[model samples]
Target: MYEFVTGPLAWIAFGIFIIGMTVKVISVIRLASKKDKVVFNHWSWGWSFRSVYRWLIPFGSRSMREKPVLTIVFFVFHVCLLAVPIFLLGHNILWDERWGITWWSFSETSADYLTLLLMAAAIVLILRRIVLPEVRIVTTAYDYLLLAIAVAPFVTGYFAYHQWFDYKTVLIIHILCGEIMLIAIPFTKLSHMILFFFTRAHIGSEMGERRGAKTW
Candidate 1:
């Protein structure tokens, strides 16, 4: 069971993740190209690329000042979310063990703290959906499920690392949850992982060119 979970299952998950992302990206490009090739070429690609930094980082935009607390929470949340998995010592060690790819990584203690922060941020985002009237009105089971999908892997990983539960059980759950997240990204709203910058870039270019009468 361990061998299958650690080896073949991991490879299958990776394959699915790669194929799914490729299909999603190609579809987006096709749709946008079909909509209007002219709009894509009219803007300077360099400027659009440059604008990605400001759009991705909430602190870079003055509009984010309206919801300062939420802005800070999300900024920190995204940082930890993106960092913990890639930088965690366990994951890095596994990468080296499995593929002989060596890289520096955060110490175990640092990863623990970051993992905690990630879970906290997920909880906060969930509570915001439930507690905020405007947000709650639009909230659905699917929204909460997406948050669960985002949080489950880390929660299980933390337990697996700490031996909080049966190590094998928690570890298996961790791997499964991580695989589920990878596969879901290209299909669900989680596609935002890839789409976020592209959409932002398109908006930035359009607004920069005054293509629309007003800025968002």
Candidate 2:
């Protein structure tokens, strides 16, 4: 009976995930095709690529003078948060056992540390948005809600890992939060994720045009 329940639910979740991702990707591609071509200046493209490279390296220099502490905290949080689940041994074990995919894992200690860092980052980001006038003025209610939605799964999963509450309940909450975020991804400002590159290129192109440069 338990197997029957979990089996069908798993299939349903898998179907939703696959279909939703396909739709979102197709929409983004269509939108991009319809939009004006965005050109980038040599320096702007160089900086964008450099930022990605810096993110991969342990500590590459990048200026964050405008919001130094907040920028550092945000980057640290994203790095640790992303690294944890993808590299964790327990997650790999589940994948291998359930789906026959084998992958490497990081240490449990590292996962725990990353989880703590991610939670701290979420809190700090929320506080920064509230306390800083510039951040607050620009933030919509949806922005705050989206942040909460994005962070809830990680936070719940951390507690679930520690068995801080009933294991089943916490696990269910974690999964539900993840599913909610998945559903919300293509509909909200979270969609900026799909549009970010184009938006950056468009801005860069406009700036170059203003400066009377042939390149964006």
Candidate 3:
């Protein structure tokens, strides 16, 4: 039964996932590569690098350092959420068997705990947005909806593993939610993941041009 569910569904999910991602990436790359009136130099790339560096090393910027609590929470939530799924024993085993790739698993306890933490953090973030009117005003409907959609798979998967409901039903819900998010990524604000670098580069070049700083 498990094999049956995984076999055809996995292939369908994977096909949609790959084709959607490819289309989105190609579209963003083409858009970003279009010629701009402003000329860009190496300094524009340098500024984009600097922006990434600042994100990594928050200590370097007062704005970042001042938001230590939010920064720590966000990073912890994002890192664990990303790492656990890819490195969990069940996920790795399934990936290896289905996709012919092998990976080492993180400890089971660690994976489970991190999944819970990520879900908790996601809930907290949603609540914060609601309770904080400033954030609520700035957040679009897509932002809130995407946040819920992104978190649903983790929550549902955790419950499914624990048999909180029927195994097949819960698992199907989790997988379906994940597939939806994957399909939506290209068409939504989530597209920022692919476009942010080019956007930054464009901004950097425009800034340099406006300042008459050597055409970058």
Candidate 4:
């Protein structure tokens, strides 16, 4: 079981993640070319880059500034989300061993703190959806499910790292959770990881170039 999860299952997860995202990108490009041809006609690299850059920075946009607390939480959440996975020492070691790839990694202590922060942020987001009237109005079981799926790996990983339960079982669950997340990315709302840029670019170009108005 351990060997299968670490070997073939890992390969399958990565393959699906890569192929799924590639197809998603290609399909979006084709659809845009066909349906949003006019939007591309006036595409402005300047506006698109400006928009993406503005949003990338903490509190850089008007909406972000308006909700400073949420912005901070969101910024920290996303930063930790991306960082903990890629820069985790154990994960980096695995990459080095499996694919001859390695990069700077955070200390175990730092990774633990970041993982806790991420889970806290997820809890806050979940509460926001449930407690806020406006958010609650649109909240669905699906949204909650996605949030759980997104955070499961980190939760399991934290436990596995500390050997809170049976180390082998926790480790297997951690790996499976991580793979599930990768597989879910291209097909779910998590696609925003990539699509956010394209959507922001389109909006930016439309407003800035076509309307002579700023998007950010």
Clash number for candidate 3: 0
In model 4, the worst 10-residue window by lDDT is 1-10
In order, how many clashes per candidate? 0, 2, 0, 0
Compute each candidate's TM-score over C-alphas. Answer: 0.93, 0.74, 0.82, 0.98
Candidate topping lDDT: 4
Expressed as tens digits, the lDDT of each residue in 139-185 for candidate 1 is 99999989898889999998998899799988988989998898888
Q: Which of the predicted structures, 2 or 4, would earn the higher TM-score when compared with the native?
A: 4
lDDT of 2 by residue, 105-124 (tens): 87887788888888899889
Which residue pairs overlap in candidate 4's backbone? none
lDDT score of model 3? 0.70
**Cα error, candidate 1, residue 198 (Å):** 1.2
Q: In candidate 2, which residue ranges exceed 4 Å CA deviation?
A: 1-22, 35-63, 204-216
- Tens-digit lDDT track of model 4 for 1-216: 878887899999999989999999999999989998998988999999999999999988999999998998999889998999999999989888888899999999989999999999998999999899999999999998899889999999999999998999999999999999999999899999999999999989999988888877
User: Tens-digit lDDT track for model 3 on 121-165?
Assistant: 887788878888988898878788888867887888898878897
lDDT of 4 at 29: 97
Q: Is candidate 1 or candidate 2 better by lDDT?
A: 1
Candidate 4 accuracy as lDDT:
0.93
**Candidate 1 TM-score to native:** 0.93
Sort all candidates by TM-score, best to worst.
4, 1, 3, 2
Candidate 4 at 174: error in angstroms? 0.5
* Cα lDDT computed for each candidate against the true fold: 0.82, 0.67, 0.70, 0.93
For candidate 3, the per-residue lDDT at 185 reads: 68
